[model samples]
Target: MQQSNTYIIVFTAILTIILGGLLSLANQGLKPMQDKSIEIDTKKQILGAVVDVSEMSNQQILDYYNGTIKSIVVDYNGELIETDEKGSPIVAEEVNIPKNFKQQPEDRQYPVFIYHAEGNDDAVEAYILPMYGTGLWGPIWGYVALETDLNTIKGAVFDHETETPGLGARITEKEVQQRFENKQIYDENGNLESVYMLKGESNPESALDEHHINGMSGATITGKGLSDMLKSYFSYYQGYIEKVKSEKSVASL
Candidate 1:
Protein backbone atom coordinates (compact mmCIF):
# COMPACT_ATOMS: atom_id res chain seq x y z
CA MET A 1 0.00 0.00 0.00
CA GLN A 2 2.87 2.42 0.89
CA GLN A 3 4.59 1.78 -2.46
CA SER A 4 1.29 2.26 -4.29
CA ASN A 5 0.65 5.61 -2.57
CA THR A 6 4.24 6.75 -3.31
CA TYR A 7 3.82 5.82 -7.00
CA ILE A 8 0.54 7.80 -7.17
CA ILE A 9 2.24 10.90 -5.68
CA VAL A 10 5.16 10.58 -8.13
CA PHE A 11 2.74 10.25 -11.06
CA THR A 12 0.81 13.37 -10.01
CA ALA A 13 4.06 15.41 -9.69
CA ILE A 14 5.23 14.33 -13.15
CA LEU A 15 1.85 15.09 -14.66
CA THR A 16 1.80 18.59 -13.15
CA ILE A 17 5.27 19.48 -14.50
CA ILE A 18 4.47 18.01 -17.92
CA LEU A 19 1.20 19.98 -18.20
CA GLY A 20 2.81 23.21 -17.03
CA GLY A 21 5.69 22.89 -19.46
CA LEU A 22 3.33 22.14 -22.33
CA LEU A 23 1.26 25.21 -21.52
CA SER A 24 4.39 27.37 -21.28
CA LEU A 25 5.67 26.10 -24.62
CA ALA A 26 2.29 26.59 -26.27
CA ASN A 27 2.08 30.18 -25.00
CA GLN A 28 5.60 30.95 -26.24
CA GLY A 29 5.00 29.42 -29.68
CA LEU A 30 1.55 30.99 -30.13
CA LYS A 31 2.44 34.51 -28.94
CA PRO A 32 3.68 35.79 -32.30
CA MET A 33 0.78 34.32 -34.26
CA GLN A 34 -1.69 35.65 -31.70
CA ASP A 35 -0.23 39.16 -31.95
CA LYS A 36 -0.30 39.01 -35.73
CA SER A 37 -3.91 37.90 -35.73
CA ILE A 38 -4.82 40.77 -33.42
CA GLU A 39 -3.01 43.27 -35.63
CA ILE A 40 -4.78 41.91 -38.72
CA ASP A 41 -8.13 42.05 -36.96
CA THR A 42 -7.47 45.63 -35.86
CA LYS A 43 -6.57 46.63 -39.40
CA LYS A 44 -9.68 44.86 -40.68
CA GLN A 45 -11.85 46.74 -38.19
CA ILE A 46 -10.33 50.11 -39.10
CA LEU A 47 -10.83 49.42 -42.79
CA GLY A 48 -14.35 48.17 -42.21
CA ALA A 49 -15.23 51.53 -40.69
CA VAL A 50 -14.46 53.19 -44.03
CA VAL A 51 -15.63 50.60 -46.58
CA ASP A 52 -18.52 48.22 -47.03
CA VAL A 53 -17.46 44.81 -45.70
CA SER A 54 -20.48 42.69 -46.74
CA GLU A 55 -19.62 42.95 -50.43
CA MET A 56 -16.25 41.24 -50.10
CA SER A 57 -14.98 37.91 -48.82
CA ASN A 58 -12.26 37.71 -46.13
CA GLN A 59 -9.42 37.13 -48.57
CA GLN A 60 -10.66 39.83 -50.92
CA ILE A 61 -10.84 42.18 -47.95
CA LEU A 62 -7.26 41.31 -47.07
CA ASP A 63 -6.06 41.66 -50.66
CA TYR A 64 -7.67 45.06 -51.04
CA TYR A 65 -6.37 46.03 -47.61
CA ASN A 66 -2.78 45.22 -48.56
CA GLY A 67 -3.06 46.90 -51.95
CA THR A 68 -4.81 50.13 -51.02
CA ILE A 69 -4.17 51.14 -47.43
CA LYS A 70 -1.33 53.64 -46.94
CA SER A 71 -0.56 54.22 -43.28
CA ILE A 72 1.29 57.37 -42.21
CA VAL A 73 2.18 59.10 -38.98
CA VAL A 74 1.43 62.78 -38.51
CA ASP A 75 2.79 65.09 -35.87
CA TYR A 76 0.81 67.66 -33.84
CA ASN A 77 1.02 70.00 -36.83
CA GLY A 78 -0.38 67.32 -39.18
CA GLU A 79 2.93 66.82 -40.98
CA LEU A 80 3.60 63.21 -42.11
CA ILE A 81 6.65 61.25 -40.99
CA GLU A 82 8.15 57.79 -41.56
CA THR A 83 6.89 55.41 -38.91
CA ASP A 84 5.91 51.87 -37.93
CA GLU A 85 3.13 49.85 -39.57
CA LYS A 86 0.83 51.09 -36.78
CA GLY A 87 1.48 54.72 -37.83
CA SER A 88 3.31 55.60 -34.65
CA PRO A 89 6.44 57.74 -34.70
CA ILE A 90 9.84 56.02 -35.01
CA VAL A 91 11.03 57.93 -31.94
CA ALA A 92 10.36 56.11 -28.63
CA GLU A 93 9.07 59.00 -26.48
CA GLU A 94 7.13 60.49 -29.35
CA VAL A 95 5.12 57.30 -29.66
CA ASN A 96 4.30 57.47 -25.95
CA ILE A 97 2.40 60.75 -26.48
CA PRO A 98 -0.94 59.14 -27.24
CA LYS A 99 -0.96 57.25 -23.94
CA ASN A 100 -1.28 60.50 -21.99
CA PHE A 101 -2.65 62.74 -24.73
CA LYS A 102 -5.88 63.53 -22.92
CA GLN A 103 -3.96 65.88 -20.64
CA GLN A 104 -1.53 67.13 -23.30
CA PRO A 105 -3.66 67.05 -26.44
CA GLU A 106 -1.07 68.81 -28.63
CA ASP A 107 1.47 65.97 -28.43
CA ARG A 108 -0.22 63.07 -30.22
CA GLN A 109 0.98 61.25 -33.39
CA TYR A 110 -2.38 61.32 -35.21
CA PRO A 111 -2.32 58.14 -37.30
CA VAL A 112 -3.92 58.44 -40.67
CA PHE A 113 -4.70 55.87 -43.36
CA ILE A 114 -6.04 56.43 -46.84
CA TYR A 115 -7.90 53.66 -48.65
CA HIS A 116 -8.71 53.40 -52.33
CA ALA A 117 -11.94 51.47 -52.61
CA GLU A 118 -12.43 48.85 -55.37
CA GLY A 119 -8.87 49.60 -56.49
CA ASN A 120 -10.08 52.94 -57.79
CA ASP A 121 -7.77 55.88 -57.21
CA ASP A 122 -10.65 58.31 -57.52
CA ALA A 123 -12.51 56.62 -54.62
CA VAL A 124 -9.94 57.35 -51.95
CA GLU A 125 -11.16 57.51 -48.32
CA ALA A 126 -9.35 58.32 -45.13
CA TYR A 127 -9.50 56.99 -41.56
CA ILE A 128 -7.78 58.80 -38.72
CA LEU A 129 -6.68 57.76 -35.27
CA PRO A 130 -7.65 54.85 -32.99
CA MET A 131 -9.17 55.03 -29.49
CA TYR A 132 -8.75 52.78 -26.44
CA GLY A 133 -10.23 53.15 -22.96
CA THR A 134 -11.46 51.26 -19.92
CA GLY A 135 -14.97 49.89 -19.93
CA LEU A 136 -16.84 48.56 -16.88
CA TRP A 137 -14.77 45.40 -16.81
CA GLY A 138 -11.77 45.33 -19.12
CA PRO A 139 -10.50 47.40 -22.07
CA ILE A 140 -12.63 48.91 -24.81
CA TRP A 141 -11.23 50.14 -28.12
CA GLY A 142 -12.54 51.58 -31.37
CA TYR A 143 -11.73 53.28 -34.67
CA VAL A 144 -13.40 56.41 -35.98
CA ALA A 145 -13.30 57.57 -39.58
CA LEU A 146 -14.01 61.18 -40.39
CA GLU A 147 -15.43 62.56 -43.58
CA THR A 148 -13.42 65.14 -45.51
CA ASP A 149 -15.42 67.69 -43.52
CA LEU A 150 -13.90 66.15 -40.39
CA ASN A 151 -17.09 67.05 -38.54
CA THR A 152 -19.27 64.36 -40.03
CA ILE A 153 -18.36 60.87 -38.87
CA LYS A 154 -18.06 58.61 -41.92
CA GLY A 155 -18.11 55.44 -39.79
CA ALA A 156 -17.16 53.96 -36.43
CA VAL A 157 -16.38 50.55 -34.85
CA PHE A 158 -16.33 49.72 -31.13
CA ASP A 159 -15.35 46.65 -29.06
CA HIS A 160 -15.44 46.21 -25.33
CA GLU A 161 -14.95 44.60 -21.94
CA THR A 162 -16.25 41.57 -20.02
CA GLU A 163 -19.52 43.06 -18.90
CA THR A 164 -22.63 40.94 -18.36
CA PRO A 165 -21.99 38.59 -21.27
CA GLY A 166 -25.11 38.96 -23.42
CA LEU A 167 -26.41 42.32 -22.18
CA GLY A 168 -23.55 44.76 -21.73
CA ALA A 169 -21.31 42.94 -24.18
CA ARG A 170 -23.81 43.72 -26.90
CA ILE A 171 -22.13 47.13 -27.23
CA THR A 172 -19.57 45.36 -29.40
CA GLU A 173 -22.15 43.78 -31.72
CA LYS A 174 -22.44 44.60 -35.42
CA GLU A 175 -25.99 45.90 -35.13
CA VAL A 176 -25.02 48.42 -32.45
CA GLN A 177 -21.99 49.48 -34.48
CA GLN A 178 -24.22 50.06 -37.50
CA ARG A 179 -26.04 52.82 -35.65
CA PHE A 180 -23.12 55.18 -36.23
CA GLU A 181 -23.18 54.67 -39.99
CA ASN A 182 -23.32 58.09 -41.71
CA LYS A 183 -24.37 59.70 -38.45
CA GLN A 184 -23.82 63.42 -38.66
CA ILE A 185 -21.40 64.81 -36.12
CA TYR A 186 -22.15 68.53 -36.33
CA ASP A 187 -25.20 70.75 -36.16
CA GLU A 188 -26.43 72.41 -39.36
CA ASN A 189 -24.54 75.52 -38.28
CA GLY A 190 -21.29 73.46 -38.35
CA ASN A 191 -20.53 73.59 -34.65
CA LEU A 192 -18.58 70.68 -33.16
CA GLU A 193 -21.34 68.52 -31.70
CA SER A 194 -20.16 65.11 -30.55
CA VAL A 195 -22.41 62.04 -30.37
CA TYR A 196 -24.21 61.23 -27.14
CA MET A 197 -25.66 58.09 -25.52
CA LEU A 198 -29.28 58.50 -24.48
CA LYS A 199 -31.08 56.57 -21.78
CA GLY A 200 -34.59 55.15 -21.08
CA GLU A 201 -36.13 54.73 -24.51
CA SER A 202 -34.95 58.10 -25.74
CA ASN A 203 -35.65 58.42 -29.43
CA PRO A 204 -32.83 60.09 -31.37
CA GLU A 205 -35.27 62.33 -33.21
CA SER A 206 -36.86 63.54 -29.99
CA ALA A 207 -33.80 63.44 -27.75
CA LEU A 208 -30.82 64.36 -29.89
CA ASP A 209 -32.84 65.74 -32.83
CA GLU A 210 -29.92 67.60 -34.36
CA HIS A 211 -26.94 65.17 -33.93
CA HIS A 212 -26.48 62.23 -31.55
CA ILE A 213 -27.13 58.50 -31.28
CA ASN A 214 -29.55 56.81 -28.90
CA GLY A 215 -27.69 54.97 -26.18
CA MET A 216 -27.94 51.22 -25.62
CA SER A 217 -30.89 50.42 -23.29
CA GLY A 218 -29.54 48.16 -20.57
CA ALA A 219 -25.92 49.09 -21.23
CA THR A 220 -26.21 52.81 -20.72
CA ILE A 221 -22.95 52.92 -18.78
CA THR A 222 -21.02 51.45 -21.66
CA GLY A 223 -22.65 53.89 -24.03
CA LYS A 224 -21.77 56.86 -21.86
CA GLY A 225 -18.22 55.57 -21.49
CA LEU A 226 -17.89 55.43 -25.26
CA SER A 227 -19.15 59.00 -25.55
CA ASP A 228 -16.64 60.18 -22.99
CA MET A 229 -13.83 58.43 -24.80
CA LEU A 230 -14.72 60.14 -28.06
CA LYS A 231 -14.94 63.58 -26.52
CA SER A 232 -11.42 63.16 -25.14
CA TYR A 233 -9.70 62.13 -28.36
CA PHE A 234 -11.78 64.09 -30.84
CA SER A 235 -10.94 67.29 -29.04
CA TYR A 236 -7.26 66.66 -29.75
CA TYR A 237 -7.88 66.71 -33.47
CA GLN A 238 -9.75 70.01 -33.34
CA GLY A 239 -7.00 72.11 -34.89
CA TYR A 240 -6.40 69.67 -37.74
CA ILE A 241 -10.12 69.31 -38.32
CA GLU A 242 -10.66 73.07 -38.41
CA LYS A 243 -7.91 73.45 -40.99
CA VAL A 244 -9.51 70.80 -43.22
CA LYS A 245 -12.88 72.46 -42.89
CA SER A 246 -11.39 75.81 -43.78
CA GLU A 247 -9.75 74.34 -46.89
CA LYS A 248 -13.01 72.81 -48.04
CA SER A 249 -14.86 76.06 -47.54
CA VAL A 250 -12.24 77.95 -49.50
CA ALA A 251 -12.39 75.46 -52.37
CA SER A 252 -16.19 75.73 -52.53
CA LEU A 253 -15.91 79.52 -52.73
Candidate 2:
Protein backbone atom coordinates (compact mmCIF):
# COMPACT_ATOMS: atom_id res chain seq x y z
CA MET A 1 0.00 0.00 0.00
CA GLN A 2 1.20 3.52 -0.94
CA GLN A 3 1.29 6.09 1.90
CA SER A 4 -0.46 9.46 1.40
CA ASN A 5 1.71 12.58 0.88
CA THR A 6 0.49 14.15 4.12
CA TYR A 7 1.43 11.08 6.17
CA ILE A 8 4.96 10.99 4.77
CA ILE A 9 5.44 14.72 5.44
CA VAL A 10 4.23 14.34 9.03
CA PHE A 11 6.57 11.40 9.72
CA THR A 12 9.61 13.24 8.35
CA ALA A 13 8.87 16.32 10.47
CA ILE A 14 8.57 14.20 13.60
CA LEU A 15 11.91 12.49 12.96
CA THR A 16 13.65 15.81 12.38
CA ILE A 17 12.29 17.25 15.61
CA ILE A 18 13.37 14.23 17.63
CA LEU A 19 16.87 14.28 16.16
CA GLY A 20 17.30 17.97 16.85
CA GLY A 21 16.22 17.59 20.43
CA LEU A 22 18.67 14.75 20.99
CA LEU A 23 21.51 16.78 19.53
CA SER A 24 20.75 19.71 21.77
CA LEU A 25 20.69 17.55 24.86
CA ALA A 26 23.98 15.94 23.94
CA ASN A 27 25.63 19.34 23.55
CA GLN A 28 24.32 20.48 26.92
CA GLY A 29 25.67 17.39 28.59
CA LEU A 30 29.16 17.82 27.10
CA LYS A 31 29.60 21.53 27.79
CA PRO A 32 30.68 21.20 31.40
CA MET A 33 33.41 18.68 30.66
CA GLN A 34 34.75 20.82 27.84
CA ASP A 35 34.86 23.90 30.04
CA LYS A 36 36.59 22.03 32.85
CA SER A 37 39.28 20.68 30.57
CA ILE A 38 39.95 24.16 29.22
CA GLU A 39 40.22 25.58 32.73
CA ILE A 40 42.69 22.92 33.85
CA ASP A 41 44.86 23.37 30.77
CA THR A 42 44.97 27.13 31.23
CA LYS A 43 46.01 26.74 34.83
CA LYS A 44 48.72 24.32 33.82
CA GLN A 45 50.11 26.72 31.22
CA ILE A 46 50.14 29.65 33.63
CA LEU A 47 51.75 27.63 36.40
CA GLY A 48 54.25 26.09 34.00
CA ALA A 49 55.79 29.51 33.42
CA VAL A 50 56.85 29.83 37.05
CA VAL A 51 57.39 26.23 38.08
CA ASP A 52 57.43 22.63 36.92
CA VAL A 53 53.93 21.26 36.51
CA SER A 54 54.74 18.11 34.52
CA GLU A 55 54.36 15.79 37.49
CA MET A 56 51.20 17.44 38.81
CA SER A 57 47.80 15.87 38.60
CA ASN A 58 44.70 17.79 37.52
CA GLN A 59 43.54 18.29 41.10
CA GLN A 60 47.01 19.32 42.17
CA ILE A 61 47.16 21.91 39.43
CA LEU A 62 43.83 23.34 40.51
CA ASP A 63 44.78 23.44 44.19
CA TYR A 64 48.18 25.02 43.57
CA TYR A 65 46.70 27.55 41.17
CA ASN A 66 44.01 28.61 43.59
CA GLY A 67 46.31 28.63 46.59
CA THR A 68 49.54 30.23 45.36
CA ILE A 69 48.68 32.42 42.39
CA LYS A 70 47.13 35.88 42.50
CA SER A 71 46.07 37.83 39.47
CA ILE A 72 44.87 41.35 38.59
CA VAL A 73 43.80 43.22 35.50
CA VAL A 74 45.35 46.46 34.34
CA ASP A 75 44.77 48.93 31.55
CA TYR A 76 47.13 50.42 28.97
CA ASN A 77 48.63 52.77 31.50
CA GLY A 78 49.06 49.81 33.84
CA GLU A 79 46.50 51.16 36.29
CA LEU A 80 44.43 48.57 38.10
CA ILE A 81 40.98 48.02 36.71
CA GLU A 82 38.80 46.76 39.49
CA THR A 83 35.70 46.29 37.39
CA ASP A 84 34.33 46.31 33.89
CA GLU A 85 32.39 49.23 32.49
CA LYS A 86 29.15 47.57 33.57
CA GLY A 87 30.51 47.37 37.14
CA SER A 88 31.10 43.62 37.23
CA PRO A 89 34.42 42.66 38.78
CA ILE A 90 37.29 41.92 36.41
CA VAL A 91 39.27 38.72 36.75
CA ALA A 92 42.72 38.15 35.33
CA GLU A 93 42.15 34.57 34.25
CA GLU A 94 38.86 35.48 32.64
CA VAL A 95 40.42 38.07 30.41
CA ASN A 96 40.29 36.81 26.80
CA ILE A 97 43.76 37.39 25.36
CA PRO A 98 42.95 36.86 21.66
CA LYS A 99 39.82 38.95 21.93
CA ASN A 100 41.69 41.74 23.69
CA PHE A 101 44.48 41.46 21.16
CA LYS A 102 42.01 42.48 18.48
CA GLN A 103 41.05 45.64 20.36
CA GLN A 104 43.16 48.77 20.45
CA PRO A 105 46.12 48.53 22.79
CA GLU A 106 44.90 51.30 25.08
CA ASP A 107 41.47 49.73 25.17
CA ARG A 108 42.58 46.19 25.98
CA GLN A 109 42.72 44.57 29.40
CA TYR A 110 46.09 43.18 30.51
CA PRO A 111 46.29 40.31 32.98
CA VAL A 112 49.23 40.01 35.39
CA PHE A 113 49.62 36.86 37.43
CA ILE A 114 51.80 36.98 40.54
CA TYR A 115 53.29 33.75 41.84
CA HIS A 116 54.01 33.07 45.50
CA ALA A 117 56.06 30.16 46.69
CA GLU A 118 54.46 27.63 48.99
CA GLY A 119 54.27 28.62 52.69
CA ASN A 120 54.89 32.28 51.91
CA ASP A 121 51.92 34.27 50.77
CA ASP A 122 53.39 37.69 51.51
CA ALA A 123 56.32 37.46 49.11
CA VAL A 124 56.05 37.60 45.32
CA GLU A 125 58.41 35.17 43.63
CA ALA A 126 57.75 36.31 40.09
CA TYR A 127 55.45 38.27 37.83
CA ILE A 128 54.05 36.39 34.83
CA LEU A 129 53.18 38.23 31.64
CA PRO A 130 50.94 36.78 28.94
CA MET A 131 52.22 37.23 25.40
CA TYR A 132 50.70 36.76 21.88
CA GLY A 133 52.02 37.05 18.36
CA THR A 134 51.90 35.58 14.84
CA GLY A 135 53.93 32.50 13.96
CA LEU A 136 54.85 31.19 10.53
CA TRP A 137 51.59 29.32 10.09
CA GLY A 138 49.37 30.50 12.92
CA PRO A 139 49.15 32.31 16.26
CA ILE A 140 51.75 31.86 18.96
CA TRP A 141 51.54 32.85 22.57
CA GLY A 142 53.22 32.17 25.91
CA TYR A 143 53.76 33.21 29.49
CA VAL A 144 56.99 34.69 30.77
CA ALA A 145 57.82 34.90 34.47
CA LEU A 146 60.16 37.62 35.61
CA GLU A 147 62.06 37.49 38.89
CA THR A 148 61.44 39.93 41.72
CA ASP A 149 63.71 42.45 40.01
CA LEU A 150 61.23 42.35 37.10
CA ASN A 151 64.21 42.46 34.74
CA THR A 152 65.48 38.91 34.83
CA ILE A 153 63.61 36.07 33.18
CA LYS A 154 62.72 33.48 35.80
CA GLY A 155 61.14 31.06 33.31
CA ALA A 156 59.08 30.78 30.10
CA VAL A 157 56.59 28.49 28.36
CA PHE A 158 55.30 28.97 24.83
CA ASP A 159 52.64 27.38 22.57
CA HIS A 160 51.52 27.65 19.00
CA GLU A 161 48.39 26.74 17.12
CA THR A 162 50.07 25.43 13.97
CA GLU A 163 53.71 25.63 12.90
CA THR A 164 56.21 23.28 11.33
CA PRO A 165 56.46 20.39 13.77
CA GLY A 166 60.19 19.88 13.99
CA LEU A 167 61.13 23.49 13.31
CA GLY A 168 58.89 26.08 14.92
CA ALA A 169 56.86 23.79 17.14
CA ARG A 170 59.97 23.25 19.23
CA ILE A 171 59.05 26.46 21.00
CA THR A 172 56.93 24.33 23.31
CA GLU A 173 59.89 22.19 24.34
CA LYS A 174 61.19 22.54 27.92
CA GLU A 175 64.82 22.77 26.89
CA VAL A 176 64.13 25.50 24.37
CA GLN A 177 62.25 27.50 26.96
CA GLN A 178 64.98 26.98 29.56
CA ARG A 179 67.24 28.84 27.18
CA PHE A 180 65.49 32.00 28.31
CA GLU A 181 65.92 31.45 32.02
CA ASN A 182 67.90 34.20 33.78
CA LYS A 183 68.29 36.18 30.56
CA GLN A 184 68.17 39.89 31.36
CA ILE A 185 65.60 42.09 29.67
CA TYR A 186 67.14 45.41 30.61
CA ASP A 187 70.24 47.27 29.44
CA GLU A 188 72.82 48.95 31.62
CA ASN A 189 71.06 52.33 31.22
CA GLY A 190 67.94 50.81 32.77
CA ASN A 191 66.24 50.64 29.41
CA LEU A 192 63.89 47.79 28.53
CA GLU A 193 65.85 46.22 25.70
CA SER A 194 63.88 43.00 26.06
CA VAL A 195 65.39 39.78 24.63
CA TYR A 196 66.01 38.31 21.19
CA MET A 197 67.01 34.96 19.63
CA LEU A 198 69.89 34.26 17.34
CA LYS A 199 69.33 32.51 13.96
CA GLY A 200 70.84 29.11 14.84
CA GLU A 201 71.90 26.69 17.57
CA SER A 202 74.18 27.90 20.38
CA ASN A 203 75.08 26.96 23.94
CA PRO A 204 73.50 28.57 27.02
CA GLU A 205 76.74 30.26 28.01
CA SER A 206 77.01 31.86 24.58
CA ALA A 207 73.29 32.69 24.48
CA LEU A 208 72.81 34.63 27.74
CA ASP A 209 74.55 37.96 27.63
CA GLU A 210 72.86 41.35 27.69
CA HIS A 211 69.58 40.20 26.01
CA HIS A 212 69.69 37.33 23.50
CA ILE A 213 68.97 33.59 23.32
CA ASN A 214 69.72 30.81 20.86
CA GLY A 215 67.07 30.49 18.17
CA MET A 216 66.03 27.09 16.84
CA SER A 217 68.17 25.84 13.96
CA GLY A 218 65.56 26.33 11.22
CA ALA A 219 62.93 28.51 12.83
CA THR A 220 64.12 32.06 12.48
CA ILE A 221 60.70 33.46 11.67
CA THR A 222 59.08 31.91 14.71
CA GLY A 223 62.09 33.06 16.74
CA LYS A 224 61.56 36.64 15.59
CA GLY A 225 57.89 36.30 16.44
CA LEU A 226 58.81 35.22 19.94
CA SER A 227 61.14 38.15 20.46
CA ASP A 228 58.59 40.62 19.14
CA MET A 229 55.87 39.31 21.41
CA LEU A 230 58.02 39.65 24.54
CA LYS A 231 59.22 43.17 23.76
CA SER A 232 55.73 44.36 22.88
CA TYR A 233 54.15 42.96 26.04
CA PHE A 234 56.96 44.28 28.21
CA SER A 235 56.42 47.76 26.81
CA TYR A 236 52.71 47.45 27.43
CA TYR A 237 53.33 46.53 31.05
CA GLN A 238 56.03 49.13 31.53
CA GLY A 239 53.71 51.39 33.47
CA TYR A 240 52.91 48.80 36.13
CA ILE A 241 56.53 47.64 36.22
CA GLU A 242 57.84 51.15 36.72
CA LYS A 243 55.32 51.73 39.46
CA VAL A 244 56.47 48.65 41.31
CA LYS A 245 60.13 49.58 40.88
CA SER A 246 59.48 53.07 42.22
CA GLU A 247 57.70 51.72 45.28
CA LYS A 248 60.53 49.30 45.95
CA SER A 249 63.12 52.08 45.68
CA VAL A 250 61.15 54.16 48.18
CA ALA A 251 60.87 51.22 50.56
CA SER A 252 64.64 50.77 50.52
CA LEU A 253 65.18 54.44 51.51
Best TM-score goes to which candidate? 2
Lowest summed lDDT window (length 10), candidate 1: 89-98
Stretches off by above 4 angstroms in model 2 are: 1-27, 203-208
Cα lDDT tens digits, model 1, 137-215, are 7667777888765766778787775766766677677777767767766678866677776764467465665357777
Q: Candidate 1, after superposition: displacement of residue 187 in Å?
A: 3.5
Candidate 2, pairs of clashing residues: none
Q: Tens digit of lDDT per residue, candidate 2, span 1-253? A: 9999999999999999999999999999999998999999998999999889999999999999988898989898878999999999998999999999998888999999999977576688999999898889999999999999999999999999998999999999999999899989889999999999888887568555769888999899999999999999899989889988998999989
Q: Where does model 1 exceed 4 Å of error?
A: 1-16, 54-57, 83-104, 118-123, 188-190, 202-204, 246-253
Cα lDDT, all candidates: 0.68, 0.92
Please list all clashing residue pairs in model 1, or write none if there are none.
Answer: 198-215
Lowest summed lDDT window (length 10), candidate 2: 201-210
Each candidate: RMSD: 4.4, 3.8
